[model samples]
Target chain A: MTRNTRLLMSMIFWAFIIYLFLPLIMMVMMGFKDSEFIGFPIRSWTFKWYQVAINDMEVLGIFAYSMTIAISTTILSLIIGTWAAMALGPTKFRGKFILFALACLPAVIPGIISAISLRIYAQSLDITPGMWAIILGHTVHNVPFVTLVGIARLNSQPESHIDAALDLGADNVIAFMRITLPFLVPSLIGAGIFCMLTSFDDFVRSFFLGGYEPTLPVYIFSQLRTGMSPEINAISAIILLITAALGLSAERLMRRNKKKV
Target chain B: MQTNDSTVRLQNISKKFGSVVAVEDFDIFIEPGQFVTLLGPSGCGKSTTLRILGGFIEPTEGEVFLGDDKVTKIPPNRRNVNMVFQDYALFPHMTVSENIAFGLEMKGQNKAQIKKRIDELLEFMQLDGFGDRKPDELSGGQRQRVALARALAPDPKVLLLDEPLGALDAKLRKQVQIELKTIQQQTGKTFVFVTHDQEEALTMSDRILVMNEGRLEQDGSPKDLYYHPETTFVAGFIGETNMLSCSVKKIDDDYVVLDWQGNELRGVCRSGTAKEGQDVSAAIRPESISCSAKKPGNKGVMKAKIIHRVFKGSFTSLSLEVDGVKDCILNATLAGALAEQLGDEEVWISLDPDYLSVLLR
Candidate 1:
């Protein structure tokens, strides 16, 4: 209530805000710097790094590959995760808790461990490590998030809606498609965006399972090892912008669905 | 649209969930165009019985018949029945017209026919011009009407309603009760309504089925159940009644003499055997007993002291204590004006022999 306390609270709040955004701000600023080095007082500003990054055929190819894997991962996770959530949402069965915990194991375990274990499993199955393997790894990591969100959405829905649908002459498949699926749209969209972002930003799993074909994140990591460059900063800024736009659109869709319901 | 064989028959239906019996040996025959109510307290199997009729759940034992067809193992979608849920379960995302058109569309009706049916239902339910509004945009009573319209759109043989007006306010509920009965009469469909409210059942149903503890206690016309209850449960459940324990002094073909606190009172025995010298209970409705400040020269008149008088607008309920009636309290419904004159004074109480329901304990 005191003036000093209010000032101190505002100071701490701004410090926390800066702690989160300062790195992002610095990366964005470095993307515009003219110098090859990433840090220090800016001598000049230019879009040369962005141009170079966009013109590099290898970087562009890696970005396209990452987009493909991320999109595939999102689609696969959405289908499998929504199905699992629907099965587990409104019923009681033996070993349900154990099954849920096992489903969530990949999300909670260290990513390095899962990546190594998956590589070993793939090798045992005589499967080659490539884009498919990376996509599989990303899906395992993202399905649990989708399932959790889906379960929360499904649990909040009233059971009588489905009962009413059936009582009004709808078959089982029709009831699910009309009532249950519509009710789950907002959560599905949100979870898809989350899974896509997670897959696009993932590095460790892609590095371990990607073999010769490097994704965008793996390519960035390799560039970092060579030396920090403005081109890497440019790509990072672009990824950040895409993710922010996706998050904003997801929120808008959720609000729109809320109004409809 | 076949109205002749629209009767619903349930033969020896029993349902059990896990170790609990939800309904046991339930049997009833609902004739076409009859408005029957399954009345009971919460968790007393009324809703369960309605659900069984709707084919939402299969009874563990017994058969369900719609017209002449056996439908015990049929799914809900295959049955010619629809239900208005307790919560009015209108789809939140759909407009009122869309919700009403759902069943008709599922029946393979053309778009034009569906639209025409929906318009008719909307007008019938007094929900005209609200068809484009979603459920959340409508009031509770409006949503309930929409739910009813949706269920009736397909013109099924039977319409089931599970406490459909439960979420409305008192005034809205009363209005809906009258509207619901009128609609059922107009549709000429067999309506199976479920509710725990006795007054609603008495006001709306042509036949009332009283259930207690997952078993049917009594089933008859409203007046029949009220005047001739077969058991103590039915007497206590149907309406307000004062139960007085007495010993049977003598038994006749039509009436029985019960000795109540050394006073021999004769009442008609409508159910159960009346053995001489056996203990029994008599259920007398409060409205059947007349109370006067001065002693009346009537055959069944008894002197009792007024313990308390509760003024309930239309009628005053007088709680009386009679001499030698040790553990039993008698209640009489007197006019407010008459009850105001007899304050803390001895009054004469007369029991109508015809209205007194004698039951064997």
Candidate 2:
């Protein structure tokens, strides 16, 4: 790349980094503000909001609800998505292209469409739009992301290694567990973290299907309507910190795996 | 019948992938403790047959025997065979020691025994002090040695190698091929090696199974295949040959009258059938054809013009244009007598019928 192009790209990259991290940084700063209103450029610092966030029963309930849904969505997405990817990735089958295309379509489509369509479908089945419905919506959205991660991982694996493993004296199941699964661990972990983070931070899908129990995103949305509070800022700060940690660890795990390869 | 101490038997084995037949009616007998190579061009059934023995694929129609047991239905891991893959196929994530210990681990051997065998194999393969490194961390030759150590670490009844040296460069390939043979001999394990390179096959194998188009063209010792190829494919594949399309005129007990390019002459028949007026193809190796500047009238001399000479280190190969066979070119290697240039000069060619392998279809 030319120097001009490199300079332009570097500027754009840092600009995007600033744009993504600025809001979280501001929210964290606002969480420490002593003033009643959680705003930018705080006049002083205090720990009252952090204290309130830890003790508030309603906020704790919302956090617990989101955590439960995110975990469930992550686990379910990984199980079904990994199964789908392995079925379609390595082996040859009729209509394989069509099956793969359909499997990947949900992640690209807008979440509102999936959530609203799932809400209608669930209502028709006489299912109350609750934790289950929200989970279903998040799973529908997360499956494609998980499947893509899984397929890429599986594709990167040289099929010869598995064949060689089998030739060496491993049965089908044993070969898969010994050779294939160990290689896939990094991608599976990465996909699981992504699924959980998406489900946790999700607002549209949770807002559409979450009926009785409010997810943290929907709770944050409700808190937004009541004007910003330092407790909300403190909670956002905690959620951001947790997601950032997951993102970093997942990235590090995949990088370590790549280094081995 | 266990007639020849055959450790592995493939009977009329055939494999098809959709419309393409990868291996067809391939029959091979691998003797116990023998180093046999399946030599062929790519797309031939050598590797496929190896896979069948490794139990990686089920033949479309055939049976495979390991000792007295039929292993056609057995899965690869369940079979008593191990393979050193073309790319080595060492697990990237595992250290060299761990990679070698994999098969033993599958056998449920305890850590102490696995470690002991791993060390022994590493030492035997000359890979000591390198167990902690992963496959990527090692050089190509090191990786190859590690792969061999891993395959041998399991103490398999049969060791199958599919183009084991194909990934290495020329120098490393020769060194490793000798190492592989020595290891096989020391271990006294049955080795079924596959390679497309005929020279390597000739050097390494006790018996070479030459294949073409998914068919076993010929199976014999390197000397036997080199001197007595059974088919046109084997003659052209296993060694260099100058094929001349000739027709038989009369067959006798000792020799036969052959019509080559409208020139009637006498040639020896090595084996099989030859009838009067039967069309046949004959092969002569370059070294078999004796070239002379002056015409020798009496024996088996055919007229030829010297087209060009290529000096190949120890020998010079002369490309000659024969009379009445416009497109037919004969390659003759000349030593002391006919080594000098006889520019565009017509020379007499004498081919001993005893040395010529007549391939009859």
Error of 1 at A111 (Å): 0.9
Candidate 2 has what TM-score? Answer: 0.87
**Model 1, range B139-226, lDDT digits (tens) per residue?**
9989999999999999989999999988999999899899999999999888999999998999999999999988999999999898
Show where candidate 2 strays beyond 4 Å: A1-34, A38-61, A95-102, A105-109, A116-133, A211-213, A241-245, A248-261, B1-6, B262-271, B293-298, B302-305, B322-325, B336-348
Clashing residue pairs, candidate 2?
Answer: A169-B77, A170-B77
Q: Candidate 1: which docking quality band?
A: high
lDDT of model 2, residue B280: 86
Which candidate has the top score in DockQ?
Answer: 1
Spell out the clash pairs found in candidate 1.
none
DockQ scores for all predicted structures: 0.81, 0.64
lDDT for model 1 comes to 0.89
Q: What is the lDDT of every predicted structure here?
A: 0.89, 0.85
Model 1, span A1-261: residue lDDT tens: 999999999999999999999999999999999998989899999999989988989889999999999999999999999988987787789999998998878899999999999999878887789988998999999999888888878887888899988887788899989999888988899889989999999988998898798899888888889998899999898889989999889878766765554
